[model samples]
Target: MRPLEGHHAIVTGGGSGIGAAIARTLAAQGARLTLVGRRAAPIEALAHALHGTAVTADVTDRAQVDAALAHARAANGPVTILINNAGAAESTPFARIDAAGWRRMMAINLDAVFHCTQAALPDLRAASAGRIVTVASTAALKGYAYTAAYAAAKHGVLGLTRSLALELAGTSVTVNAVCPGFTDTAIVAEAAANIARISGRTPDAARAELARFNPQGRLITPEEVAASVLWLCLPDSGSITGQAIAIAGGEVM
Candidate 1:
């Protein structure tokens, strides 16, 4: 039998990148999926391809989150697995960081996690087993230059994951964070382009600069992060709560 057969999962930011990859993986394992994102088109296309439901809602907004969950429940039943994969990152020096930028980072990276988790908690508790995985970043574990706001928000995500893991101890629910480093996604591509503009280097060179952080000397793939998330959601992984699993190719260690 498939590991996730008959489970219902909600994946935030499921339109593309890591969230889309995770959604695909979970669906292949037989889970019914709800793809949630701020934009409907991308997720709707993905959901159509995957035979899942697409929900349009901004995770940062509590009302939208609640409405999305209600829609998801109506479409796919109660969520048994929650992947808090909706996030954004901005690169700005500490000195230049504005209040709006800082709050935006926190809203998408940290607040979205809070709102989604709370909205799904009841369904998770009622499930035979529940798994909550947040796609945090290596920034959550260590500092990154010109990303103070992003780093701080990711750090908050890790803290929230740890706290909830402990708070839900002894229950069937497991909460954890997957921290990836310099993933090769559109976000990184944009960052590389920004670096190219600032440093007058080719985009490839700018990408290489970021990849140097990983011992493997390559950016992590979205599928690799999805694999880690899949593992955490397995029935055998009930004891793995509260941990921050790094998929950074040894960057953190």
Candidate 2:
């Protein structure tokens, strides 16, 4: 039998990027999925393609997250695997980082993870053996030059993951974080655009410059991050709790 046969999983931000990749990979591995995202179109499209359930909700809102979790549980059974992949990122000089921007990043990146994982506990406990994975960033382990707020929020995610892993230590549950560096996702496009506007380089040049941080001289792919996530959910990964596995192509060290 497939490793994840009959398992139920919930993937937030499953509409696109790393989240989409994770949802697809898990489904292929025999995990039934419930995909959650703010937008309906992409999530629905992905659900149709992957034969998963889709729920559109703004993860930053607690009530919305609760509703989404309920919908997911109804469709896919108790969430034996929770992928807290919904997040936002922004980069700005430390001196220019405004409170509003800071809070927005925190709400989507840190607060959303808190709310989603808390809301999923009942279902996770029902499963008895569950996996909770958060998509953090290399910035969480290290620091980023112009991404102070984003880095802080990701760091908060890792802290939360470690704490939850300890809290549920005796139980048949695992909590971990996946920290990716310069991945080829829409976030990279946004960053490239922002950098191009600020530094007067073409967006293509900005992307290349960012990719230089990865020792491989290339950007990490969403599929690669998804694969690492799948590995953490395997039966053999029961002992790998409270870990922050970096998918940064050796950039964080």
Clashes of each: 0, 0
lDDT of 1 at 41: 96
Question: Of the candidates shown, which would achieve the greatest TM-score relative to the real structure?
Answer: 1
lDDT of 2 at 179: 94
Model 1: lowest-lDDT 10 consecutive positions: 244-253
CA RMSD for every model?
0.7, 1.0
lDDT by residue for model 1 (13-100), tens: 9999999999999999999999999999999999999999999999999999999999999998989999999999899989999899
The candidate maximizing lDDT is: 1
**Candidate 2 Cα deviation (angstroms), residue 86:** 0.7
Error of 1 at 1 (Å): 1.8
